[model samples]
Target: MSLITCSKGHQNPEGSRFCTLCGEPLPEHNAFAGGINTGLVEGTRLRDRYMIKYQLGQGGFGRTYLAEDTGRFNELIVLKELMPTGQGTYALQKAEELFQREAAILHKLRHPQIPKFWELFRDRKGLFLVQDYIEGKTYQDLLNNRLDNGQSFSEVEIIELLQQLLPVLSYLHKQGVIHRDISPDNVIRKEQDGLPILIDFGGVKQTAIDVATQLAAEKYGGSGTRLGKSGYAPDEQLRLGSVAPHSDLYALGVTAIVLMTGKPPQELFDAHTMSWVWNRQLNLSSDFNKILQRMLAQRPSERFQSAEEILQQLPAVSTVPETRVQPHLTQRQITSSNNNFIPPSPAPINTSGQGHLLDNSVEVPDEIVGWNWGAFLLPGFWCLTNRVWIGLLSWLDLSVVTLGIPTITISILLGLKGNEWAWKSRKWKSVKAFKRHQRFWAIAAFILWALFLIIIIGVILFAIAIAGFGM
Candidate 1:
């Protein structure tokens, strides 16, 4: 005998509160009460606008519908109706409160990545939240096609995808909004622009103390409770109680891992042990692997503190150092001013849109680009230094010079290349004349080499003097 039945009078889960025909919300009774068909009735409009069109989707606690706004003007929005999860009447009250909280949270957030909130309405049907209707397919759709086609994305492609989301997360975290649910299902990749849009605010938690106070929040989505998807939730998120930004980072790490390996992280990584799958074909670089490992750390504190900090380490998507601007002075100021600044009124500097000033006359420094010169040469600086030191300390000076000189030169070039990153990061604060002073360092290096040779010769002469007595 069928005990549990849906609104269409069809057997369903015990105490189901949804329709079997359309999956619409049924009357509230109890947690395990049978669903009831209230018969179709036009819901009462709230604030004299937002006419309910039809049901779009329904969950255990709420029903979403496509609605038209008539109060201010005719605007299209998806209205989520907060309905009771079970047949219990108390469930209706609790669901209404949750829906209101969701509305308040949504209204506070405004980001390019998140959907825009339209309005919140409550009337005969129940509490409803209207939000932007993003026209696009979810990330799940892309992942599905990727699996079907046996598709693989390059590191650069993955970076481009994350470049959009990381900044979004940074903004959200700064605003104290923790997006507890971040998975392919919630991410919408637009066909027109090919950018991922984060949706589904029902699971979003506002950490802002002031705004959070307005809406009485019950138990938060914490770790150990397994609020989010199994593989994606961080150690902290599964516990339950308090949620943090790193919880989202854990999900992001899982998302990237899945995208790269073409398998859910659960299949590859054991959250309990934090171990990768048995010898999966690894095509990614060691650096990327290290990044994922850090983000998916068992401890929240061990993960990258913030999205901004994580972006700093990623070479592919990091922001280049802004170019420094040279201040443009009037002819009068340049010609006059005692050849230097003499005026009490200083000339204004404009750096609105400019790159770093460069000395066109001199060649670009090697430090800006990491170009290893010694890779082509055998027996590098260390080899050269050993030969010189061993020869001078002993008696084989000629043999040492022959082995060491070329290696030393190659090592110098490599050192310059290695130092380029540091040099480029530094803003050239010096004027043109100061820029020319860099040549002095080159001259100094040669002078130091000459000095080393002189010492070696002096040492040889002293040894010869001692040998003369034996002769």
Candidate 2:
């Protein structure tokens, strides 16, 4: 393997698109792209550097993974493995060239708001494009939080978002970097500052879309419809790859209105007229509506050519926290969920007529509700292991003094109540964990009981042998 150093003095793999250390995009003219293979299980280490944590998801043409970089003091980064639809080596090579071309362009991009593309590497498994791991919940996550009162994004919040992200887009576009894909799913509301960080710059994605589209046309005699891209992408951009800065703006406008309306673009736009009817869904100030309308114009020439154009109209709007000026949307107040303490959900009760302990505060799952072998064999030791303190009562001298009748009764009680008593005594992660813990005790008890039986039999046999020898 060869290494290439960027202007920032960061050494990367020979064909890496950006410096892994500083995310510096090197000057163009150096191009390298490779194919990706799949099915690297969790914890799989690549090049003895990146340890795969787990898969993030499968995308339109690739898989994403959350990995730890051992070489960088275990920094978290995202590994994207591109899975081109084309099968032949030529097709794969073509896909790589296209991926590399877009990636090289994306390498020129650097912004705090956008996720940093680091380096590309190849291990035995496949090629991986490494990038910073953003820690935040995406807008989609916030939007889909329906059970949490189903709050929609308010006008003020949307305005704030535009203010924050429009500058980022301006930076990217100034360098001729257009994020072909902009959706609620791609924008993360960073947990640290609550500022949005843009992920999925659409370099590899655009490459895949190109390859997939080409393959579709070659095989099916016509270019196939892209199912997921339809809602966000404009007709010209989706049907053809003639994308500009306005294309991204169009998608952002759609995303903004979607967040406000809590509806997808497919629903908001009337296909019959081929124009937006989002205004009918919700009311907005004229200034905001006018801006959004210009951004979403059907013709690229009609839409705003630059992100700065959108930013100039939006002055710094003061936002109220936890305020709901609009009944339809809410800007969540800076308060913990505990402050509005809802009553704890009732515990699941055993409905099978099985008695419980601690007034049924703890659930006795049916799977563990049975006679306990460990309790029956060694009540004292089983009590220690299972936390069933009542099982120790079997050792009382009163039980032995009553012709062992009390002891027998206590053992039966221990066996019958073991599961319920243990369920109440301690906290368990799950029913499976409880069963596993009890199983170990059962095995240990059986082993000790067998050893005791063997010792008693040996002593009796030795006593008989001694008497016979004396006789």
Candidate 3:
């Protein structure tokens, strides 16, 4: 068989059953008629180093093969075979060049949560990417297993998973790398040495490249829209082409929904109504539900600003120990790290119903909700003292000063209170309780503001009535 090359540079047997380089089976060839004709033989040596062992798995982009590393004294390894394609061979070559560029970025990341790449090799056949072989069950596999059992994980369990996964994202974001494709299929959880290790770093994106430039080109080609699983992708990543750290968080949120519900995200979504079904079906904890909603927000801006932001914002698992929690989770830590732009700390966890462990007495007041007598008093004194110096109030000035001044005062007071209680105080026994306290004050402030608006409207209506009656 003369080494007949396809347009993609894949060599095959003279009358082969498939494009041996890629497992593109020869047209009309039976699936069982295979006997490693042209590809690397089971015992064959590559570059007089790594030895091919057996085939593992094959996909559109590449094929994974189990092999032996001779340089490492025949250490077991996995080879990812990158195939050549015809439709965009020139484009694919360019893509591979781009892929290698990104691969260099990933090679520098050293985290136990990330998969390790061994080496990249090329020969007369094609390009091959060799990485460490991690044996474990993928999140997808876990979902399938639970589905088979007609059961799903509890909300607490799902949040615990998120706690572990979010940290991996935080580390990546800190390094300026984004895992654009964060579907369950891509996240593998292996129990190695009694610890769960995250595997697969194939879809990482670097901050160096112009995301818009590449994104615009691949919007219709599954490079953007189809990069994730259908239901689990964020609305922005799926529809608006916004890819950021939040995009990963959105996928994780979707995965959490699936994990808790034991169904794929599409099943939980009502296309006609354009709403999720989990809320209707499950009686979920308000705290966990809120976190999920934030993660799945349709707008990127409305979502967490960064992976660290998401980590900081995620309410700690009610049942998990604080030490297992990430440091970025408390609002104070996030604000402190941000220099002067500090957000108030989260409220204490309410251990009511399932929150029995939470203690409200020790919880911090929401800095945004607590009373700031100083702000109100100072502003009132300034206005009263200066009234004689200023002229009579115009209609516009009255409206502005009447409504705007109070609104501004309330906002400042709440901000100050939130800052004091949530961030500054470590008096609370549990950070979870502090988180709950913050939520309570936030809701209370909102209700109070709404009532103030109602009262103002009532007074305006009364004034109009008096004027009309007099006239």
Highest lDDT: give the candidate number.
2
The reply for model 2, stretches above 4 Å from the true place, is: 1-38, 146-148, 213-228, 315-471
Q: What lDDT tens digits, residue by residue, belong to model 1 across residues 1-471? A: 334433224455555544343232333332323354232235645557777676655443345667677764767677765544333444445555665676676688888778898766656545566787777877766766554443443454465567679999998899787787677767888654556898765252221111222222333432222245556666556555357888888788777766655565656775466665512544555566577778877777788889987787774422222211222344566677576944232221211112222322223443334433222122233223222121122223237657756445545544444223223323232233223333443455566667998999999999999999889
Using lDDT as the measure, name the better of candidate 1 and candidate 3.
3
Clashes of each: 18, 1, 26
Q: Mind giving the per-residue lDDT tens digits that candidate 3 earns over 155-199?
A: 655655665678888888888876765666667776552223555
Q: For model 1, how big is the CA root-mean-square deviation? A: 24.1
The all-Cα superposition gives candidate 2 an RMSD in Å to the true structure of 19.5
Q: What residue pairs clash in candidate 2, if any at all?
A: 322-333
Instruction: Give per-residue lDDT, candidate 1, residue 70.
Output: 77
How far in Å is the alpha carbon of 262 misplaced in model 3?
1.1
Q: Give the TM-score of candidate 2.
A: 0.58
Q: Tell me each candidate's TM-score.
A: 0.54, 0.58, 0.54
Q: Over the stretch 308-400, how does candidate 2's per-residue lDDT look in tens digits?
A: 999888633332222232233223432446446432222232222222355563446778899888777778778886667776776784543
Reference-based TM-score, model 1: 0.54
